[model samples]
Target: MTPELLRARIKGGEPLMDLDLRQLVLTPGDYAGAVFMRCDLRGVNLAGVDLRDSQFIRCQLQDTIWDGAQLDQCVFHGSNASGARMRAASIKEMNWSDSQAIGMDMSEAQWVSVNFVKTDMTDVCLKGASLKQVSFTECAWGKADMSGTRQEQVLYMYGDLTQALLQDAHWDGVVCVESDLSGQDFHGQTLQRCQLTECRLEGCNFQDALLEQTNFKGAFMRGAKLINARASRAMFVYADLQEAHCQGGRYTQSLWADACLDHADLSGADLTQSILHRTRCNGASFMNAELEYADFSYADVSRADFRGSRFMRTQFHRALIAGTRWGNKAGVLEKDPLLFEAEQWSAGRPTAPRAGY
Candidate 1:
């Protein structure tokens, strides 16, 4: 198709479907609200075109240059958009799904509410892009570079995250499910309310970061560093946190039910109002920590240290305390530990205040 022929057809409002338009020379013209289905636009130079609200379904758009195009409210479904360049494009309210966007370069683009469902985004470059309220569902990603991007409220529901590079990215309210973000650096970043359920976070650094109300349910957080992190009310239910460093952190009201805290150092940490029911706390440390209102019911605290810890209303109901060290506690001391201690474990024990009045 020639440039004049294509312009005439578009101006005449003709159906541009199932046509071989690989020979068309695109000029700066208005193609807005145009619908092209099953069209082979391979290697088309559609740069700087006005394609706003345009729909392209099952189109062959491989290596197409859409850079500086106005793609606002555009729909691109079931299209082979591999190696397409859409850099610095204004793409808002776009709905793209079931498409192959592999090796697509969308760097420095302005995206808002851009949804991609069931799409293949392998080796996609989104560096320095600004995204707001964007979502990716059931997408197959591989080595997607999201470096230096400013993102807000992004939701990723897929799990096949092969080598996602998010270096120097600013995130707010990011949520992921079953995603493997292992070995990512989140140091000192504010990740409030970020839910990473059933995800693999192995060797992830969250040191001194603000992780308030972040959910890590059924996550693998082994060797993760959370030192001095303000992670109050965070959920780690059924998470394996073996050898994780959480020393001197504020973990108030956090839940770790059936989770593994073995070999983790929580020294001088404030675990007030926390719950660890049926959890494995083997070889953990709580030295000089505050355990007020914390519950450890049915948990195994074997070989754990509680030296110089201050506890009030901290329950260890039916918990295995064998080989656990307890000393310098500010709470009620057991006077008759050899006798009536098993009775105390069976029933609620009586407490006496320190006679300092």
Candidate 2:
């Protein structure tokens, strides 16, 4: 139908149509007002075309090639564009909501102010792309290749970016609220003021990343690897980081109130000037770690290891220390219980050691 006319216009060099253009190779043409609704445009080649303000609503555009195309202000609502190739395209201010774009290769493309709301873009490639102010709200971008992408001011609320390849990407001022970033690698990335609340980040890797003032409240990061990370003024309130490997990480002035760190390894790490108020570190390892000016008030350090760790001016008031290996390398507390209780508590304060914990 319209696809035959488009091919005739491309061959006869007449003009392109504005209707359903499915399975056609009409390249090097201008396609203004191109509307492709309910069309199957699989294997169609529309490369090097100018499609200004075009719309593709409810279309099946699988394996379509749109390389080097100019698609300004275009919309792709509820379309299926799986395995499509859109490399190096100039797509500015496009809206692509609720689209199923699995396995699409959009590497090195220009996506300025694009909206990808509620789209399923699994295994898509965006390597070396500049995505400034892009909104991916409620999008499923699982296993997407975002490596080396410069993403500034991106909002990814309720998005599933689990296992995505974000290695060495610049994510400054990115907000990822309620997103699943589990098993994602953020090694050596700079993340400032990032909000990650109530997300499932189990087994995620953030090794050696500069995380200044990041909020990780109520997130589940059990068994995550954050080794050698630099975190200053970061907040982890009530977060579950059980068995996480954070060896050699710098936690200067970080706040970790009421967070669970059971069986986590913090060996050779710097915990200087950090707040660990009421934090549960049961069975955790802190061997040879720096604990200068760190607070462990009312914390549970039972069955925890702190051998050869620096504890200069570090508070240990009301902390449970049964079967704990202290800096003296002993399995028991050396001080008398009554004398230690008398040093901090007074008369009639019900200070009979608080009824043995």
Candidate 3:
């Protein structure tokens, strides 16, 4: 009955604004270009409707199900869409910015060129969705379920991905910039070919993960764990890895140029052909590690430990080695006579540091 009025409104070119249409069931309607502004559409089931190019401005769309509907080019501006379900919908080119979309379900939906800026999407379920070129800028994704999603060219700039589920998802060319993903667990997950540039990854775990060719340039990964991970040719250029633990990791041919690895533990790791030019390795440990053909030119290796490490053909040109513990390390550094300095300080050197890592 109300859909007939909606059809009449569409036919008369009258905009639907400030109406309490909670009982509106938009079933089988070609109400294209329908404009719903500030309407109370809480109980409206917009299923199987052709609502293409519709505008929903500040609508009360709580618990509204638009499953299997065609809502292409829809604009949902400043709306409160809590618990709304749009499952398996063809929602292409949708703009859902500045909206409170918490707990909204968009599972199995085909979202192309979608943009969700400054939205609070906490606990939103996008599982099994096909998202291409979707950008979520400055959005809060706390506990959002994104497992089994097939995303490509997706951008997550300045977003908070705290406690987001990303298991078994196939990601291609996804870029996450300046996002706060601190204390997240990505253990044994494969994030290959992804870019996490300048993101905060403090205490995040990437244990045994495949990170080949992934770029973490300028990332702040303090106290992060990458144990036994295979990250060949990965880029950590200008990254801050202070107090990070990468023990037993395979980092062959990886670049760590100008990186801060202060107090980091890379013990028993394979760093063959890896370059650490101008890196700061103060108080770091590479004990029993493989450093074959690795380059550490102009690096500050002061007070660092490389005991029992294999250093065949390793280059350390002009590297500071004051207070460095090299226990029978098989390598000859062509150091300048002036570069060799003496350890001038140390009161009571205990078996470990005061801050027991």
What's the CA RMSD for each of the models? 7.6, 7.2, 8.9
Task: State in Å the error of residue 2, model 2.
Answer: 9.8
The lDDT for every candidate, in the order shown, is 0.88, 0.82, 0.88
| Candidate 1: regions farther than 4 A off | 2-8, 11-13, 332-357
Reference-based TM-score, model 1: 0.85
Candidate structures ordered by TM-score, highest first: 3, 1, 2
**Best prediction by lDDT:** 3
Off by over 4 Å in 2: 1-18, 23-35, 39-41, 189-192, 328-357
Which residue pairs collide in model 1, if any? Answer: none
The ten-residue window of minimal lDDT in model 2 covers 327-336
Candidate 2, number of clashes: 0
Pairs of colliding residues, candidate 3: none
Comparing 1 and 3 by lDDT, which wins?
3
Per candidate, the number of residue pairs that clash is 0, 0, 0
